[model samples]
Target chain A: MTIKHGGNIYEVAKKYGISEGEIIDFSANINPLGIPNKLKATIISNIEALKNYPDPDYKDLVTAIAKYNNIDEDFVIPGNGATEIIFKIVEAIKPKKSLLLAPTFLEYERALKNVQSDVIYYLLNESNGFNIDKNDLLEKLEDDIDLVVLCNPNNPTGQIIEKDTLVEILIECKNKGISLMIDEAFIEFVDKEEEHSLIRCLADFDNLFIIRALTKFFAIPGLRIGYGLLSNKNIKKRIINKKEPWTINGFAAICGDVLFEDYEYIKKSKEFFRVERENMYSELKKLRGLKVFKPHANYIFFKVLEENIDLKDRLICRKILIRKCDNYVNLSNSFYRVAIKDKESNAELIKAIREVLYED
Target chain B: MTIKHGGNIYEVAKKYGISEGEIIDFSANINPLGIPNKLKATIISNIEALKNYPDPDYKDLVTAIAKYNNIDEDFVIPGNGATEIIFKIVEAIKPKKSLLLAPTFLEYERALKNVQSDVIYYLLNESNGFNIDKNDLLEKLEDDIDLVVLCNPNNPTGQIIEKDTLVEILIECKNKGISLMIDEAFIEFVDKEEEHSLIRCLADFDNLFIIRALTKFFAIPGLRIGYGLLSNKNIKKRIINKKEPWTINGFAAICGDVLFEDYEYIKKSKEFFRVERENMYSELKKLRGLKVFKPHANYIFFKVLEENIDLKDRLICRKILIRKCDNYVNLSNSFYRVAIKDKESNAELIKAIREVLYED
Candidate 1:
């Protein structure tokens, strides 16, 4: 009955009898530069919005999202978060059989299950550094698969599917009359995102569905804002028409307009991650009992090599929280994912890992 | 494919070329007091929570809600809003056949449709002030009906089902092995709510499911928080095991603790509605071209007497927004509903209606 994945800080805090505010968590991948000051001030000054029923049509937010992604406003359907969008799209399509990647986001499976769709997984091999090879995937995207889901810069691994590879898959799926949903939730954190994103192909590929979130990079997960982009007019209409009113809260609606266009926050975030992700990856790689993988996003995924220590338990004793990847399909107890945080916190995690691994 | 619902302020504002902030909206029912000052302060101070994911299990929020409602903590499941809970319950149970009140909240139909459930309605008679006849509804709950939904102090009509009627239905449903869900979302605005609410019946009836919302009563619809109370352990486990993590945000999580105990706001809101609902209802009753029903909640429902006039269009011209009831199953363009607002706003609505109805 335990359905929880990550970010259960209150449970972790209470079980350990520590204050939630005191725990330094790297369990969930979020923007390292905290909340944007401009967005914070906007939320505080416009606190009155909580009283109003959010616009059911969500016109302005949709317009803003459409403009940001260079898509038609009619093709955009914003949700409470990317999670809701995933569920809605799955419900609307009602695919007979769905194909998902192993060690992917859990919500995709949950969403498909809601529609009673039979699901099969394309296992990503750990030996290949967990990266998806396009030709291998396209071979599997036969006519029998009604839908295919691919997460860019995949979670728990921080591995990116190459741009040309994605285009090939999209073209093949289109030829086979299959729907392709690409979850680009962490794309903004990847260096040179334009090379890895499917936003450019959206105008040409009606079979593609791209989900983008303002939660992570904009640092407003508590506000719950995300949107989907597609070129298929009929599919977009079906999804939007079936949605519940006010799925995007008024605060989140306001956030989409302001944060999506907040270029200053964007610039600052990219610079911080570009420098910090590398620094954290390098520092962790120096440890004797750990293997740090090359990360393309804000989080680094690593595996413990030594047989004597329980890495997740040792880190928990030190009041450090990192995601244990055991729950992910094909991932074992030795795998862990940590968000690349500020210099001080990175130092703390490094020191704790060294102390736990080297202690005689 | 047009969805009949409210809370799309962004779309309406753009359609009419009006700034959303300028429109006096009555289309969606919400508390007039806006976000609590303390909650606002909490959100601003805890803005950094946006940098981290919300606690997946929502323990603190659930504990606070349990304390507020005087129930066991395990009996509740808090959600993004009441809508999220409603969808989850339907999916989990996968009811064989369901019963709904016609012209009630529209989301029930959409949720049922997602699961492909057979839906039948017990339409409320307008001649009877839209009241539910317990005897008639009981007879309709035949052998095949797995679930029955009741919106107490029902939306759009503002009609309250008697306490004894709910008790009789609850007993009947339990005896017949059927689950009954009573949505008390707007119950706080109704006088003698404790008498009509099934909140206390959870221990006695395993088939009872009560849905409550912090959105309307606390005036934080933008925060998106609500919960479900049920005594059935099996159903509870199913919902908990299938839901998306962190559906409720951090500020909303804290809000369950703050607003539930905010005695001042509760007192002020109750007092304001006690006086204002009566005045607004009386004024509408006096109108020359409308038949206004007695309102037990913070909203009044009415029918246009004159066939030549479009009340929704006229009200829109006066910069006032009211929900058109034509979207509801049994309702038509002749029906409309408006909220009981502050004294000044109430007067403004009354004056506009008089001019539109009686003026040459």
Candidate 2:
């Protein structure tokens, strides 16, 4: 069987005989505000520009990223998406033995496998609501571990590793000669993202690799643009030298032209998700048969308390799609993740999910 | 120095302090006709759809490609571009000893190098108009060579390897247990493309891999979509299993929704490039200081007869950008390739070259 990832509304839409437009997808954790109006106009205007190849160096795209993050341009490497960066980093590291957070983002494990790395997972404790214990992670970091990958505001669980905790891990890994890679794909969704992010510590940690994406927050997963920030120039050069050219599509290359600077859209989306995530989280917690983990980003994760419930199947029957987390490592069939969408969609999902629970 | 590829109007624009819109680019061999009007409209309509992740399976895309080529869907593997397919094929084959046409597309060599493959070049003799000597190439295909790559209607030289010769090479390579990859990226620009393409023989040779791109023929290089065709499902499966997911962007994936079926646009483009390529070829041949090779695609390759004249520098000063073939293997500073553009632009380029030649 294929190991499916979330955001598979295409498959669901086909299977359920529902038009993609009709389906309220709680599977993909994308921005509820959708693509910014200005970004759409920018894309339309640049349609004719598709005749030319994107800059091979992606100089302007890099500039936008560096300026947005207040980092030097040399520290940024733009990619097709954060997924591309994850794979490239693994290739550059060629880690012989790596440790990853179980129940984190799935791509890192696949990437590690590509490099033939022996992967040891520091399984996040379910009883502890899938939180990463700093001391426990440090103890798990052996000298033989060449790399450690963490998904900040970890996927399917939505538990974030605070900035100070990340620094401790970075330092411990550095001391043990292990590289640290943090994927902050959904960080912008959280309040006080700067306080939680290790961007300021980038210069101090040459071994650090931070993955960011325009996919979720900007709601352009289809456009496929993301970037990585690293202090190590050698690894950065290795990635640039090794990657396939023009991987960034023409529209995607110009995405940052409006994305990083769309202050209004950014503010509006953060505010929307902030309210929706909380409301959705509380609603899910109100359900008697679910144990909702406190969400850190734009998605809420919960485990069905009742056994053998087939909740995803039931929810799909009601034309509401939610991510079944069984495919993720250390996750089970009872574990499900639902994206916090717009107010109306959230209400529909909650109602559908409630009906499924009550019917069981 | 950076090994530059064609279609870098971005770099030229920055260095020359001219707007990219003003520069008539002859470096890239894209279709003379810009993107299809229907495609532009389809993209705009799907602007809101960018919020959703593109169908991961790309079913509609695969169907369009399969239908267009009259091949089984199993035989096709869609990629970010032909460049991505090149890299993926090299990774899947892991060829220890590979033979490639030296003046071919540069990406093949770079891809081969990534796997540390021992690259032996079949240097197309410039004195022989860069033509592939069939007998010489056959003799060079030793049993020990694991892979062989050829760019039909080869890049920078514009010489084609006919179907019969390609079949012979394929059979010989198969017998010797060597994989054969034929890149037909520019074949559509040639009249009777089917006659020159090895596509008909694909079923007979599992070792055969054909790379096709919409970049040049469809004139959407920035959109980034291409595919590789092979009869070997194992290798295809290997590629799919190993590749980074969703490498093809949303807009690029849906490109086929209009591209393959747009018979009117395809016919018009082919008609345009056919006349343009001939006119451009003849015009270049008439130049006093150049020896133009007969072109098979929408581009002409030539050598500057006069020594110590910086032709590219001179032309760029005239606000025209053409490919300097110095970076291509087995090609030198005097070598150049220029795209066959619209008639007016072609005339402008010719006039500029005439001025540069006489000025020298």
Candidate 3:
């Protein structure tokens, strides 16, 4: 069964008979910096872009993406969002047996299953900080596994694998003729993102497929533009042949032309997240009966120390929404995730958790 | 091979060293009325809609579509475009063998091919006016054919199937355990559309599936919003389960909130097309070497009488683009389709054709 995702403020608003504006949403890990001003200006000025069919080839968008990533245009495959990219890449590979991290982005498992791929899980241990251990995972890299999908700064945990370790796995997978698909959806939120990202390794490793999203970092989840990069021209050709035309809407198709060039916005957002993430983490740790984990991305994941507490429901009483991670594989009702929002919102979130835990 | 679709002024402009604004695009049959002003205002006002994830269920949008069509909301499944609906419905059915009109929408064949379905075409005869004869079609619905796909006011021909004939096909399909998928993308352009639409028959016939697009009618093809209507709850649930989330971007999602309410725009556009389609059809018949087919929609279909003329290339010399129908099955190099634009544009199109055929 597919677990309903969080960040559905619309559903909550309707259910509670309140306006969407009234609720504080920390469920989806979206950037607090909001959409870039330049992009908004671009969209309004070019509102007529929707007047005709989007360029099916999306030449300008592709060129921008290629330039942004410093990768060849041939390596990029744009999608409606990173979600569509996930499904498309899986469909392209058609793996028989795939390996994924437990409590990772749920979409990867869903995408794999859609292709009738059997999924194997490598459980991240709480005792070991929910971090992927190199040798431990390497042991699970049996000959039978055809594909390995990793979510960098993995969802619900916010822990990222070091570049060297990631490269080791990539090399091993290559030797075993296994394709490694890494989702960099939140890679931009992490400090020194390039060090953690394997996108630069694409030319060196034909087996590597990296998926990235403008949704989370740019905070335009509703606009829907993301892409996958791979050096394999053969698979890329096959994917283009099978994929639907113009899946990316007009606004999304042209966003790359302005978004990649927004250097000030990118730098400011990076610095803001760097400060807010640490502040939120420290504040959460001050509360009683809460085990807060160190977060690398813009969201923090932790477990409730107290038993029989209903932390999520309690926090929701204050109209703040956070993700309950129990639905993820190998996770329990004790685990929860919350976005690192703006400074004021983050403080309110910390205070709410404090009130829910100690005041009640 | 997938035929590259027309109306890509982007590709044509780049190749010809001309700006997109310089060319006259008639290859894509978009409404000359352009986008509704009310929807554009709504989008500009709610620019923040793109800041967060769109409603995963798209309740408001779905409600609007249901109310607009007078169909129960349960029967509606929204997609990025009518093209996406084509692919999704075919994927859900997974038919082993399907029947399609030879010169219908190319996407159906592509969608069918994606599912590894064996496609059999019923070649539309020129002598029959490219019309589907009830008896001729019924005979082709052998035991092996599980699906039948039709493009009403059939593409590149603009010939429509009457309600009585369509009902007969639907009933026969239901009796044979075959699903009849009809593309009503051009139905809105047809005179007295309700009389030809199968939407009313959806309640009575479980085998009936209908697709409609806001793209052509609203002239927002780049925004990409369309839907499928089916009485089958089981299939609807399955499609939703397998489908990716938020394929429709935010602007497309919210446009429905305002668009369906723009009754004046709808009425005016219908009247405009009514006058323009006829005017263009009558004017085209005056051309020296063109055999004009009576158009039931906003586009006219015709065949060049002259031999070895390269009509499409000749028109390109004047920067006037019309769909070259030769790429479509059963359509020869002589076949072409052109959209009916506003008065001045229509005259220029006819004048250009006259220049190509007679003046040259």
Best by DockQ: 2
Better of 1 and 3 by lDDT: 3
lDDT of each: 0.84, 0.89, 0.89
Per-residue C-alpha lDDT of model 2 across residues A262-347, encoded as one tens digit per residue: 99999998888778788888888999999999998999999998877988888887788888888787887889998888899999
True contacts kept of each: 0.63, 0.79, 0.69
**Can you give the lDDT of residue A40 in candidate 1?**
85
Error of 1 at B162 (Å): 1.1
Put down candidate 1 lDDT per residue, A137-183, tens digits, no spaces. 88898798889999998987899998888988989999999999999
By DockQ, highest first, what's the ranking? 2, 3, 1
Worst 10-residue lDDT window for candidate 2 chain B reads: B1-10
Tens-digit per-residue lDDT, B26-54, candidate 2: 99988877899989999999788688788
- Model 1, span B105-213: residue lDDT tens: 8888887886788999999998888998778898998978999999988988999998888999999998898899888999999887788888888998989988898
Error of 1 at B144 (Å): 2.0
**RMSD of each candidate?**
2.1, 1.2, 1.1
Give the alpha carbon lDDT tens digit for every residue of A1-360 in model 3: 134787888887787776889899999889998989999999899988888888998888889999999989988988899998899889989999999999799888888988999999999999888999999999899988999999998998999999999999999999999999999999999999988999999999989999999999999998999999999987788788788888988888888978999999999999999888888888888886889889999999999988698777887778898898888999889999999899999889888888888788
> Between which residue pairs do clashes occur in model 2?
none
The deviation in Å at residue A343 for candidate 2 is: 1.0
Chain A TM-score vs. truth, each candidate: 0.97, 0.98, 0.98
- The list of candidate 1 runs beyond 4 A from truth reads B7-10
